[model samples]
Target: MLLPAASTVFFTQVFAGTPGGVSPEQAAATMVAMMAHGAVGAALGATVRLSFDRASGWLRQLRVTPVPQTSVVAVDVAVGMLLTLPPLVVVALTGRFLTGVRLAPGEWAGLVGVLWLGSAVFVALGLLLGWALEERAAGGAVGIVGTVLAALGGLWVPVELFPSGLRAVAHGLPSYWYAEAGHAAAAGRLPPAAAVAALTAFVPAFGALAAVVARRRSLPAVAG
Candidate 1:
């Protein structure tokens, strides 16, 4: 997470100081990328926790509960949300200190909200991967794949740097969408109402998918 955020801050400052100044829109875009990076980090942390639980047989014990299997995914998402703050603060401060990025007080609040919302999407995706794989080794594999995709998706580097074809593919990924929303909020181009709507739709959609995956995985296989 710091990797992506630091890269964004460094590049933004570098570009802003060059012949072409970094516009507010561009600065917001960089923030959005950094926020997505933080979200991915949160997801990775959750994956690690789930992997540990599986390896230690803790997940098997948790499975004995009367609570729905979806509860596992919910717990993971909750933990991910809790884990998001430190990295969020680091990225925000890095941008502010290094790039001298400033936002109105209201915009600052909005940016934080956007970051949380984006984190929800990544957390849900992590939960889905954990439930779908149902093994520690599989979870580790998925985590590695996720990290690579994040880099390819421009979470570490701006999509603007990608070739036109790869950039188009990257745009279809959730990280890109989250980054766009964050950029809009940070840049003040997104209205509060619109920002709320985007997050409202994204969080529930991903959450539901995670719940479904968890429930399906919990069911015992039937003999043919």
Candidate 2:
């Protein structure tokens, strides 16, 4: 949260006024994607923290309780989405009043909706990582994954500035589609159907990964 929020403030202030910037729209376009990307980091934080719970055998205790593990996961994802809101309000408010970037009501609707959908994609990813990685490794893994995705996915830098090859790679990442969707929404235009479809598809695909990990976690350990 600190990293993304701090970086967002720095990057937007520094880059929003680049010389001969091809598009003023692009210059002021950080808020939408930044909000969603921050949510991904928050989701990862929740997952990594829960990984410690699993390591400490708290999850084993949960098995005796009435709550389904899926319910726990759902709660975590919802909390992750909520975690995104404050940073977004802060960043958007700063962008508008401090940086002079603005969005219309409709554009705000699209940006926030698309951003949340994007966060949903990563919430699933975070769940999978939490279940799959050992507790000792989950924290480092979460940081690395979030940073790499944000850097390459154009959450920090616009995808347009990437070299052709790098741009191709960025397009293949879910983060790229997330950022692109936000960009489109902010411009008061819908993102391409393919981009929207890709983010939608990723949510289920990553959810399946988490489901697989959850099943394994529930299995009895084999004796040597």
Candidate 3:
């Protein structure tokens, strides 16, 4: 509900500045942001779901299984990634049909890459939040933080419309780069090689942080 509303509102605003309406590029970019935001929501929800199950002793009831804890996390990530695809396709197709948005082959490929990379980042961030906080706290925190970041990161609106200082701060977040990469792809412009490198770096950096947090929590507690 929020995703479609955000995309529609964004397109309407962008179109307001044009003679007729938004260009295909603007529409494509908005679609990419909408899809990516949906993926982020799935990833966050999956992480919280898994965390709740773990905290509730579901894992222990399975007995001493051969599956590693990390493998369990991997399964959660895979499930979240898979769950995101349908919504992405639905949003993309709907945007194209309703708004006459079109993407070239190269632009489409770039858009897909952005969605994958963006999903990876959000999944890692979700894992980190889940491992670092209690289940209830983690879910609430992720929901609130994700909503604000999505709004301020230009996923819900163009950053250019934001105040200068706020926009500058937004640029420091990973979401900003993800949105920028999508926009570049939608415009049929090749993103800088550096942007790809930065995204690659962020994946492992956050994933490792989440792994470390999860590992620490898995350890036996010391008597205070």
lDDT of 2 by residue, 1-224 (tens): 55555665677667646776424474457666667577777767765566776777777777678999778777778876676666656666655665566788887767777676667787788878988888789989998999899889888777888999999999889888887777788789988788889998998999898887778775332234
Ten contiguous residues minimizing lDDT sum, candidate 3: 215-224
**Clash list (residue pairs), candidate 2:** none
Q: What does the lDDT come to for candidate 2? A: 0.74
- lDDT-superior candidate, 2 or 3: 2
- Model 3 ranges off by over 4 Å: 13-19, 61-63, 218-224
Which segments of candidate 2 are over 4 A away from where they belong? Answer: 16-23, 218-224
Candidate 1 residue lDDT tens string, 1-224:
57757776777887789787997666666766776677677765665466456545667676787878567656776788878767777777777777677888877778777677567766766666665665546556655766765777777677888999989787667666666677767866663554456556766786687567655554442224
Model 1 residue 71 lDDT?
79
| lDDT of model 3 at position 92 | 66
Across 1-224, the per-residue lDDT of candidate 3 in tens digits comes to 35653565566576758788676657666777787677677777766665666577665543367878667777878876776666666676666677667777777667766676567777777777777777578778878978976887788777898999989877777777776776777777766576566667777898899878766765322224
Ranked candidates (lDDT, high to low): 2, 3, 1
